[model samples]
Target chain A: MAPAIKKYGITVSIGLLAFIILVAIFAGQVAPHDPENGKLDDRLFGPCAEYPLGTDQMGRCILSRIIFGARISLSVGIIVVSASVTVGTAIGLISGYFGGLIDEAIMRIVDSFLAFPSTLLALGIAGLFGAGFINMVIALIIVDWTPYARLIRATVIDLRGMEFIKASIGLGMGDLFVILRHVLPNTLSPLLVMATTGLGYVILAAAGLSFLGFGVQPPTPEWGFMLNDGKMFIRTAPYIMIFPGMMIMIVVLAFNYLGDSLRDLLDPRMKMVIR
Target chain B: MITDERPGENRPLVEVYSLKVVFPTDDGIVRAIDTMDLSIREGEKLGLIGESGCGKTVFGHAIMRLLEDTTKVTGNIVFRGKALYSLDRESMRRLRGKEIGMILQNPGASLNPVLTVGSQVSEVLVLHKGLKKRTAWDRVVGLLGRVRIPEPERRAGEYPHQFSGGMKERAVIAMGIASEPVMIIADEPTKGLDVTVKRKIVRLLKEVTVEKTMLIITHDLDVAEEVCDRIAVMYAGELVEIAPRGAMFERQLHPYVQGFFQSLPDRGLKPIPGMSPSLIHLPEGCRFHPRCNRATGRCRTEHPEMIDTGDGRCVRCFLYA
Candidate 1:
């Protein structure tokens, strides 16, 4: 019953996210045809009774393909973010807590990673490792974790001077205990907000990589890969690109809205405005 | 020079000799504490009184070694016959809570907001005494009762924000004494509480620190008079006077100490003239000469050393010399 959830737009956003997740979870049962099955006679068909949205150049059902693609987009988004946040938070805690040569070294490496545009960095990494699902995920993780590290480090730096942290240390708790107990919990709200928002960006980045042919290889029901296959026939069979593109947009928007609403809900300074 | 002597006690518990703390900042180098010397005997309560920014808290942090690493600290701090500064980080960590406890100035800021009051206190017990969680919980409840926190069982389950200011302070005190430290430093324990609550806090502190040594830092003379056995007056980063509580109130030697007592509402409400000196650019010689009515040419040119008077009294002034 947070005030942010009471807003009409955010409620709808939450519902949309839930619906998308459900569809992704039950993709096989929800779709009428196999996403990979194609008929030569029905190639490039538009808005038939059986093919509601239409068919692609290979006569594959676009609706079925887009529904199954949700699974890939959501899974990649979740896994990559989870791995990065774990690694990034640990690095940030150590760097900020110890705060001397260690801080300088870690921060300089983070800065170097940040210097390159994230997409360009991911592209280079993916290109080097050779293109595929796991390589693309690795590339995305490398490009994504710096923001988490930087944000958490900044928060931990401020919290290290707080009296509670000093009191904990004065009580004979070691550095590890203080950082884990006193420092990490304080950073959680901001980290959560960042993670929720970062999910949308990660999904978009994954799709972008796939669109450029470095993601899920051919015949996979990934939305970005579908968009890549349909681009050549855009003028002739626009529905092939349009339906999958719309699915990506809706999922990303759902995540962005959830992230924004969570920020308003979790930030104590925003309580008055929310109320 | 007269040497002030207490009747029988010898070998002080904590001895600080010529301690200096300096911080280099963007504005200038802040001389926070300058060549200060003090001693606290076992089972004695010493009150440190000074204006804000006059190095009282800094002196306490110096004893605890809690100041930032960037700060420049010089001179020795001997606690329980061990040199505190020369100890390794692990040894210092062990000594901090087990031997010397600290109740910070702001209770609200000193308790973690996200943690339950019980867990925070029990953390100390578990860490220092190796008490199991279940046993620590019962001890935490007992500690809460000792501090006179009402509904000790239920209150322990609540977070800091759920408690009132006075209750928060009591909780902080509970945490401070959890390890049964030999010396407890309570910094402005009753700073923002009401008068009634202040008296209660003082009484609670007095009861808990009966046989233990304590350093109570406060600008309020009444609070100090209520708890301290001996009082040390600090002015502009120096210990201007140290005397028994009764002796200080009956006869103050340093002019600044006299000015301090005079400004009290019970003592004519006369305000001390001139602002406290900025630490960055302190006066050339005796720091108090610029504001002293009894100042002479010699007083301005010479920094007076602490001259001991008989019967456990000392003052830094030319009049005593």
Candidate 2:
């Protein structure tokens, strides 16, 4: 039915998601050594026997820290996006379903929140909330939710007038019930596209905050902090910066591709792929 | 299947007395429905005909209380001897789809795209009847079968996009009759269908809801003549003429009705005199004087009341004077 949710997008998305999950679940065991405990004599060793992907300036295993860092990045990203989607979708559904005064009030608030560029908003909130992973996620949720709410609200405005919605009403559903079961369920196509795409941004934003020293703190082994640590050794041991920077790019690009492909496949207008 | 109780002597099951619908726009008030009166008998197929923007659909929506909140409607719409205007939104919701169901001009847009044909049909059953999922699914198939959808079991799981135009209309029909509503208001239900498909859909609606009354809204006189027991012509937000189907086709009164029939595309089509008046600001006195070839000095000065022409036929025109 519906061509099995399309392998091209779903496969890559699920693949990356599974890989990220596996690393997060068993990062301690998967990484070869403790990220901070360095064997100083073997410091600055370039990709060789006892270590892999080269060692950082402190002689800590770059591979180990990168693998362990996966948990923090993914956790913040997933948590922030999930929280944002839930709040945004619910608000959007309520505001959009009951148009006029309710819609106007909700929209006015969303517009005011949307006034700030998302990253700047998140950074300001994160900076104020103090440096913690949970706080960063909370900050991201505040800025991120408005987009989902706005998009869903726009879509719902048009869809509410459709007969099926009327049928739902006729069938005996109250406005809230109908908005949830009928309206929200049908709006998954766009939400799904946003989810995967939004996750990458969430990941990048978390990493950026960490690199700025306002996230997770030093010795936490986040990709952004790893990159920041490596930047000082640009001429001496370039592997430190390149490796962590490469990790972010690979994951981000994979998720982005996965989102784009899934967006197309899930789309009702893409009849060519439907068969 | 027909109800024996009527409103009063020669009165119908539902009667709208001096129905008025006004819209407060930026420019001026749009008297969409200006003191119109009508009635529908139990088990009667009454066709409401009008040119574009003549307020036929709005009248249907107003009676259903499905109009926008911006609209200020003042009238006594009595159904089964109870006034309908005073009903709250929840009560109206109960009345709609349970007592009175409406189908739109576009079948494609009306049905929810995400839900299957079965789910959409069963939505009415589950909502109004409070049936369980299993019972709803079972009845969904039954309802679909009633609407002439072949291979009902398989078709139920399929989405709206899978069905053709005719099939989609049938699905909509299934949803309407799921609760066995007393009256079905079909607003141009066959507008987009080819003649053959249109004929099939009309036939399907008639077959499934034979016991229930239908207010079939259409601009086409032939469609009205085919299925409707009686025809009511609307123009400039008023009923210009009404008669039994046979009488209407054979001996019509009111020049507007005459003009509408002439405008009908008969084999090649009949030619009408002029366009319909705008509801926003209708011409004073008679709404039809501008279009009526028989318009006199008085036709412009005074509005003619809808009077019976001694054969159960009603016409609102000075020509009868």
**Highest TM-score model number:** 1
Q: Against the true structure, what is each candidate's TM-score?
A: 0.97, 0.92
Clash totals, every prediction: 0, 5
Candidate 1 residues lying further than 4 Å off, grouped into runs, are A1-6, B1-7
Q: What is the lDDT of residue A203 in candidate 2?
A: 89
lDDT of 1 by residue, A1-275 (tens): 55455577678988898898899899989997889888867899897899998988888898888888889999999999999999899999999998989999999999999999999999999999998989999999999999999999999999998988988887778898999889999999999999999999999999999999888887888999998989999999898899889988988888888888888889888878766
lDDT string for model 1 (B122-223, tens) is 999998889999999999999999999998999999999999989999999999999999999999998988999989999999999899999999999998
Provide the lowest-lDDT 10-residue window in model 1 chain A. A1-10
Candidate 1 backbone overlaps, count: 0
Per residue, candidate 2 scores C-alpha lDDT tens digits across A84-143 of 999999999888888889999999999999998888888899999998877888888999
Q: Once superposed on the true structure, which residue ranges of model 2 sit more than 4 Å away at CA? A: A1-17, A40-42, A170-172, A268-275, B1-11, B24-29
For residue B230, give model 2's deviation from the true position in Å.
Answer: 2.1
